[model samples]
Target: MATNVAMDKKPARQTVPNAIFSLDVVKEKERYDLWRESIACIFEVDGDRALRRTSDFKAHVDANMFGPIMLARTWTQQQDWKRSPSIMARDGMDHYMIQLFEHGQMQWEDGTGLRELPKGGLIVFDLAQAVKTRTNDFCNLSLIIPRTMMDGALKPQFDQHLRVLAKGEPMVKLLRDHMLSLKSVSDRMSVRQAIEVAPATVGLAAACLNAAVDRENPHQGAGIALAQLTVIRRFIEANLSEPALSVDWIARHAGASRTKLYKLFDAFGGVGTYIRDRRLRRALLALVDETAQYRPIYDIALASGYTSDAAFSRAFRAKYGIAPRDIRGNQARLVDIGLPTDDKVDRRYERWLHHLSV
Candidate 1:
């Protein structure tokens, strides 16, 4: 977007120095050294052998902090970039890089088999691990997730096994498109807006990593199940008026079994209970609206999937300790439904956010 061309690096914000940066690789007599510095500054890694080949290098970076995680994107061309054992020892290591490559002929090794990404692909490699890379032209959007922030994300076996995400994989493609969109609009964002998007960045990256790893292992990824639960929740909300919306339907929609669906929604109680509670919750909102008074209770009941008014009324009273008609008379507003309605779900999310801050 708005790039500061060939200028010295300066802090975008006083409080957080790394909000954004732009550098145009100025070609001077010692331009090779400057290129090396540019690569190091842009990627926060070491050993830029590409500067030896050509001095034509320029890059821009937009970095935002979400808790301790940093979301960043760089558009630049450099040849070979390596993070060797010496660099690791010198820099000290406690972070991992998850990169979505847009263009590059990159052959990178992390003491495992080499992953050569020429086109579209993503890579997740830890800094504590060994790294050596040879590349022709490389450009990417990446995130730096501190090891502590990755607590529930990376298992030991996964850290050792899954590193590169192939171009055509579903999760990789989705994350790539997502980051591209984020980058396109990032220049217009404020520090507050950038901070607000950090959790989304973490969640999306975590989901993609888990999906890719589970796909490789073929043991039915729990990550996929967790991600799919979010989709199913939206589906349930959209179809609450339908009479056939049930636990079986939700399981089928999620591609999860009835048992798995039950477990996924255990925090909200059983699947059926959750669906009923949500429907009743919506019905409560409708019941309190003056605009909806023209519609009879039986109509609202049927719309909420009840066969008759009696069943809906009984369920409503059992849940709320009041008849449906009484809500309007008693001036029941949104507080009558209670805040959030699920402490178990809220606490679970609170703990996840806390881990990110750590």
Candidate 2:
């Protein structure tokens, strides 16, 4: 029999927000020139920076739903490129800027400290700050989002760590991927999609900021730490049957060092103890599985990573105040034993079976 199935090729129509700009064109040098012209125009009209024609530059501006974020590469022959004092006056309008160096080095006085933003590093500054950034020849990415949009996502405590060089993280990779995807399908996104995308973008931005900042509220930070801990614990539970699952393995899977992994588990108990407890608990559950009625206690222990029946029995007795044999015996007698017949008993048994399968 031959079957024909039609597949839809067009995207679904949704209420999409207006897109500001997309990096559609890739004229590298021309893009940079455009950025320089725009900056020069701003400086000329507002008299913010002491506009110096000391460097040849190139930039590309990719507009988002709210505003434009630019990737700029520029060279400077002189060291006098600085922002004018009048620039600080206009900064009250609340313009935010983040500069990440792709190559070369740059220096700036960030009021609190003289920050040196090296290659692969980032610096964030408010237009209102009396700060001046200087570089001989630097290539960088600059992101400019509305201040109102940023205010909603970032906590006031993270203000100091606003500009951060991203270390390797899944969230960072996700944002980079999303940016690339946005560039590809800029015109396809509907107005509603654009609006929805903004919140997702903010969530990623907030995560990045959270990674960079040291929170004043230790309690709130602890909650985030606990959530991450839960993820690690869940991973441990899923792979308990694998004999090779050790502390090092768990650390590698959790994207944390062995020491950090141990510390995270130490809040409940030591990692070694936790692993043993979890294995024993899983073995106990498997012993009660009604579908596995024919399986021996030794087989259940072995499946849960215990090598010897004697060793497994000793641990099981220590944990549950009874030997594995007694536990299995009790489970087997559940059908034969006379007990009170109630709706509660039936519901509890059904729930237990469902949990065992899970």
Candidate 3:
């Protein structure tokens, strides 16, 4: 519940430069002129090839391209030459560049290997080493981030793989969707949002790469998967009263397979059983609340996903060893029951009583 501002309020000295621009409204040549000026100023590129331009698709480049953390531009271009190099120099900064190509073909060297990227391929390269890229007609999304970020999050697999196509990976699809969503509002990202999203974006990138390469580290993939599943469970709890809720519906909305979804809730039992227990718990709390005495038992049952009051009462008695009517009648008296004399009482019983007044 703590705000990000409250967590890191030392004020970062504002040393990180901002290099964002838009090319939709400018002339083609003028846009290209501004691109050279902005990139050269930020990266401090002294060579003429550092400012070279290669194609004409009305392309636009707006980026925060320096320091330990930077944003890479996503552009669509068509090249007539057999080999065209966009930028082939070193910035003396130790960072990793990630490229996710959507279409066409390109090749590059990342010090360890010569990576050839086809359509739907992904490439990760080091910035300290000299690299050359050749593309005929390419459209891709690129990310420039600190090497330490990958070192901590990715660990062993960070250096083992240079390029991947990300075939059949759910995390890759999620990263693609998030990047596209961010691109839709590139002009409106606040400085704080951009900073917070940077690490989360890196985490996703690491997850996609690890998933693609079949890495053995379960912690990286499990952490992101659990966080996403927690969000989905919160959504399910918020809409419990709606009769349309089901495993298939929640899985579809969360963009996960039913088997993966079930595995996510393994610590709490399976997804279907979890849903049933949550509903039963809610119904039990309703039964114990003094103000709910006027409500019909059938209404509470329906609200908890039970079609019939008789079936709800059966399951409630099987779990709690008491009828729902008795609990509703003795609601006020049950509060007098003393806290556990030993440490053997069920915790769910305490939780139900705690939320009864809310």
Candidate 4:
């Protein structure tokens, strides 16, 4: 005389590495304070008394990280933002930020001088430098990328900070559309897919920057090497899966000499090492992706240009100190380097910024 019973079980929720902060959810009295604290990592923010009032405070942000790059769409009331020498020394980040204002206006002063950013203007900021800005109630999209990722794309002394491009230019429009497209589809992209897309996005950004520089100064020959290296890097990213992706093939295709190509990547360990590192990293991501669990290890190895399973295993172990299958589905979560351990403080955005690395 046993009775049958049904068991109640709920599926575990999937976690995505994204942040959305809206002032509407915060208590009225704490909204402005929370907003200022949330952005403390990148900017010291404050507003006029009227905008800072409990009843008047308003801000919203949606941010997503794709490997070494981050894209954010933000809306806020009038505020002042500053990045001083102390803040730069404390944070120790030298990343590049490309911001596009969709509405409202802003006036900023940096080492270059004071400038105004009107609606539909795109500007670049170098985080290593000092700057201050006062803005009208505004909405904007920001793309933040590490300087390491721009290695071959931008010259070290380019002085591109505060460089603005208006929406009227065809190249600017294309660049804006590309960044927006990535944002729109980011939610559906897996960690592996996002990592793969980062390089291409950087390439488009470099193209826009180089075009701007060429138009501004035709006599500047300093960027020739930068442009050549950019082409080589983009070619490497596009053909990482090909087994024949070698220095000779890349040199021929990218119009660079073998010696020049080798020299260009010398700082990053030679050209061969760069290709091997990128391929191994891609394979590692694919192996850890839960959505790609059904894919065979051999298939992943082949895609990474390793035809032999043993070779792939040996190379993977040598690089990561673990077998390819050891941490497959067990470690599907995104790894955040240098994230804060204290949970009592709400620094989610700061954690995300810290997690960004090359």
Q: Clashes in each model (backbone N, CA, C under 3 Å)?
A: 0, 11, 0, 0
Q: Write the per-residue lDDT of candidate 3 for residues 113-215, one digit (tens) a residue.
A: 6756655546666543334466544556666665557765664523422455463467767877766666556556656666667778778877876677655
Model 2 per-residue lDDT tens digits across residues 323-347: 7677655643332211112221111
- Which segments of model 1 are wrong by more than 4 Å? 1-27, 38-67, 75-78, 109-114, 160-162, 215-358
Q: Among these predicted structures, which one has the highest lDDT?
A: 4
| Candidate 3 segments exceeding 4 Å error | 1-59, 64-68, 76-90, 108-116, 157-161, 215-358
Worst 10 residues of 4 by lDDT: 332-341
Evaluated with TM-score, which candidate comes out highest?
A: 4
Q: Is candidate 2 or candidate 4 better by TM-score?
A: 4
Q: Best to worst by lDDT, what's the order?
A: 4, 1, 3, 2
Runs in model 2 lying further than 4 Å from the true structure: 1-37, 40-85, 102-105, 110-114, 136-139, 169-191, 215-358
* Ranked by TM-score, top first: 4, 1, 3, 2
Per-residue error for 197 in candidate 4, Å, reads 0.8
Which residue runs does candidate 4 get wrong by more than 4 Å? 1-16, 110-114, 215-347
Model 2's TM-score against the true structure: 0.39
Candidate 4 structure, TM-score to reference: 0.60
Candidate 4 clashes between residue pairs 3 or more apart in a chain or in different chains: none
On lDDT, the stronger of 1 and 4 is: 4
Regarding TM-score, does 2 or 3 come out ahead? 3
